[model samples]
Target chain A: MAVKLFYEALHDGLEEEMQRNKDVLVIGEDVGHYGGSYKVTKGLHEQFGDLRVLDTPICENSFTGMAIGAAMVGLRPVIEGMNMGFLLLAFNQIANNAGMLRYTSGGQFKIPIVIRGPGGVGRQLGAEHSQRLEGYFNNVPGLKIVHTSTVYNAKGLLKSAIRDDNPVLFFEHVLLYNLKEEIPDEEYYVPLDKADVVRSGKDITILTYGRMRYHCLDAVKTLVANDIDPEVIDLISLKPLDMETIVASVKKTHRVIIVEEDMKSGGIGAEVAASIIEQCFDYLDAPVIRLAGKDVPVPYNGRMEETVIPYPKDIVRAVEDMLALRV
Target chain B: MVQEQLAPTKYDPIDRQEALMLYRDIVLGRTFEDMCAQMYYRGKMFGFVHLYNGQEAVSTGFIKQLRPDDYVTSTYRDHVHALSKGVPPRAVMAELFGKATGCSKGRGGSMHLFSAEHNLLGGFAFIGEGIPIALGAAFAAKYRGTDQVSVCFFGDGTTNNGQFFECLNMAVLWKLPILFVVENNLWSIGMQHHRASSVTDIYRKADAFDMPGYLVDGMDTLECRQAAIKAIKRARAGEGPTLLECSTYRFRGHSLADPDELRDPKEKEFWRKQDPIPKLTKFIQEQGLASAAELKLIEQEIRAEVEDAVQFGEDSPEPPVDELYRFQFAEDE
Candidate 1:
């Protein structure tokens, strides 16, 4: 196993996929000679040349739509959003063209494309720059959303996204770029619709994904010290929600707490909580609580933004409050 | 240097064989669409049946100039374009009827049409959506070193869209082989082109992107053909993309649902006089391309084909209810 940063693992995964398939192309603004805005695509343009690594103008909607067209005729295009927030301009193409084209076209055109970039509650990043579009796009059908929380899974999940026959939206947290972990030397791919059981415990099922997964771990340290052993499950797949894994975990723990960076209104936690109630209603010892960000535009101020986003302490408090409930 | 081809005139250069083929295709489109109007009124087809009544010349003129392997994308008014691209009339009719035998397997009605074999990408209902998709097909052609030129067909309303400018810029920057054909029929539903656009001259907008733009006589098939031939030649030779503004008009309202009353009756009367079908028929006869009897025979044959297509649609079954969830994901063949 070799230690790799989260961004470096993502780069390695994209490079390997491109090398394995000549049809795979990397296209976005600053993705070519500039080496991508996040430096995740560094050294790729030099290796693949302009044909495979293309630098598109900042027309997000058209370029994304163009990539979908290319995918139809036998090309796998990976579109890197300079920032995921900027992709709101491309929501039309992503939803109307990419998301619904195959089904509306009667499956004649198979869109094998991956739209990936870094976006989440950032460290002092402006409201415009910091966006959790995963929630915005989760309601859209025909899209597979995968958010990678660690270095090992970032590489594995990305390769799987590139090879998917349908459109896959790969969400990477901006603040977790430097997180490092050792990964196997051989090429490996993680399933796009599975959750990672980070830690096993009998007390409760702590559900989280992306950046919040690490924050949940921070709270877990205190919980373990206080004799509260909460089971942790990282939901890598945001769209399908991995009902098999989530339901089983809920059945065992009988208590659920969801922590996420997305806003509270119409967020991933709401969907998960609803699914749990619908599927595992009798297994619960307490009502499922969600420690999601406040439903508002993210603030740029360090302290103000922290107020909206849930930290490790908030998760610890929520678990303690839930534990005190006898019903 | 001496001018090799004559300037735009009543009739441009076209051989007898090519002229007959164009006449036949135009007739098929007009006849098929007229049948669609009948079916739409009688409730055989549903949901925004946009008839390509007077736009036959544009579809035939441009598509007839392309190789079968080349790709084409169209807007909601797409049945004529699909027919010109060699999608079978029966299959297209079945699709409009929402039957399983449709080219899109009954999933896509009038607003969406697709055929992988013929490479008709789709019929996008939303304006300005399919241009970038066509640009991608052209990009793939350049990436694979194929001489295939991708063509996108949209109405004058689509010209006002941001995607129009965006795609034109990329097509020039990447030097992709594509043709942005705007069938400027002068109205986007009830919105008049003059009222909606700052520059009603859509072809002139191509100057912003530094690509060649032409204002062609869309009511004349030979003239439209001459313009298409040049653009296709430039694209095939890897020069770059071209924008062609074909000044045409739709004889019917925007869709069957729309009442034919928005435009000044005078405007409709004037365009009706310049209808592409009669113009082509006169040019072919006067130029000694085809005799009156021969043209009549061709029209008769196309009518039978269109009638048989209606029967095929009527006989075809609706997609099974049990498989409603099918085609949403990629299923292994």
Candidate 2:
């Protein structure tokens, strides 16, 4: 076993996949020699040459569309965005081309393309740079969405994503990149649509994924001290949502609190809450609650940032509110 | 005398055999579109049908010069491109009818025909969307050590889209083997050329990429073929990309539902006179290449071929309802 950071694991996974498959290529701005803005693709260009690891111009929409086209013609392309904020320029390609190609083409074409970039707030990054777009992509059909919380899962999940024959939105949290974890020293792949149970409990279900997953676990630890046993479910894949896991969690706990870093209104948490209400309404002991970031631009100040984003205290308060409902 | 030299009176010097094939394919596309328009009005096929009526010469002239392995991506007005790229007439007609036997298994209607066998990549409904995709196809072909070029066909209206400029820049910068064909059909929907663009000339738009751009008479099938052959050859020779602006017209409206009363009767008259099939027929006869009776026999053969295709589509079974969820997610179990 080796101690790997989320970025390292992602790098290793991509490098191995590219070396194994000649059809696999990497395309993005600063992805070649500079090794990406986040350094996730560091040293790849030197190792693979310019052909396998390409440095594209600052044209996200065109390059993203190009990646989809390459994928259609038997190439597996991994398009890296400098940040999720920059992905706005590429929304047209992703939503219209990548998300609709397979269906529009009646399955004549397959897009084995992965668009990777860091999402969620970190440090003092201003409003534009700190947005979370998982909700936006998760709402789009014909795409697989994945967010990883640890190095092992990131690497495994990325490998699985590369091998997947569908277009995928691979969201990597900026804060989780440097966080180290033990990764198995062997080739492994994780299934795309299965949820991972972080901690099992019967009192309340804390549903979340990505960086929020670690925070939810921390909140669970705190809740345990208060004699509140919360079941923490890490939703690995947002699209192709494994409602079976959420429904089962609600059945066991009878109360749910969805914690997400994205804003509350029309967020992914709202969708999850709606699904629970629609499917698991009768079984719920208390109404399903959501703990998410406030609906506003993520502030640049560290003090305001901590208060603006969802934290363990918010999770604890939401759980206490559910308990009050039971009384 | 200037016209003779510029247009090249001798088709032999430019490869006459290839020119003949192009003419035949252009006729085939024109016949197919004419039949579709007639059938569409009779309610034999449903939904939106963007007829490539006057644009036949551009598709036929362009696609004839491409290798079978070369990729062709086109816009919503794409029947001519699909036909020229060798997609079966039966499958295309079935697609227009929204039947399972259609090119895209009935999922895609007229605007989204796709065939991997013939390398007809797809026809994107969104304007200018396929340009970048064609560039990527070119990138892949080059990466695979092949000399195949990818042809991206779009209307003059798509020139305003950012995707078009962005793809053109990338294609030139990367030296991608891409041929951007602008089928300037005089108008986009009811909107005319002047209202929609700063410069009505489509070739000027390609100048921004520092690439070679040519403006040709789209109604002249031989002119279109000659231009496309030069562009495709340059691209295949690793000379990067070129843009060919075919000044064409769509005799039908944007879709089957559109009634083109917005166009001037005089402009329409001017284009009608330049209709490619008749022009090519006249050229073939005057050159004594084919007799009038022989050409009439060819037209009869084309009509029968189209009739058989229509019958084949009408008789084909509809896709089952269970197939609704099919091809939705490619990665899942």
Output the lDDT of residue A60, model 2.
Answer: 91
Which residues of candidate 1, in runs, are more than 4 Å off? B1-6, B10-13
Tens digits of lDDT, candidate 2, A146-232: 888888889999999999899989999988889889889989998888999989999989899888897888887878999989899
Best by TM-score: 1
Q: Compose the digit string of candidate 1's lDDT tens values, residues B133-221.
A: 99999999999999999999998999899999999999999999999999999999999999999999888888888888888878877
Tens digit per residue, CA lDDT, model 1, A1-327: 999998899999999999999999998999999999878899999999997999999899999989999999999999999998889999988998888888877788899999999999888888998898878999887888999999999999999999999899999989998998999999999999999999999999999999999899999999999999999999999998899999999999999999999988999999999999999999999999999989989888888999988899999999999988854
Clashes of 1: 0
Q: Each model's C-alpha lDDT?
A: 0.92, 0.86
Identify the candidate with maximal DockQ. 1
Against the true structure, candidate 1 has what lDDT?
0.92
Candidate 1's TM-score reads 0.98
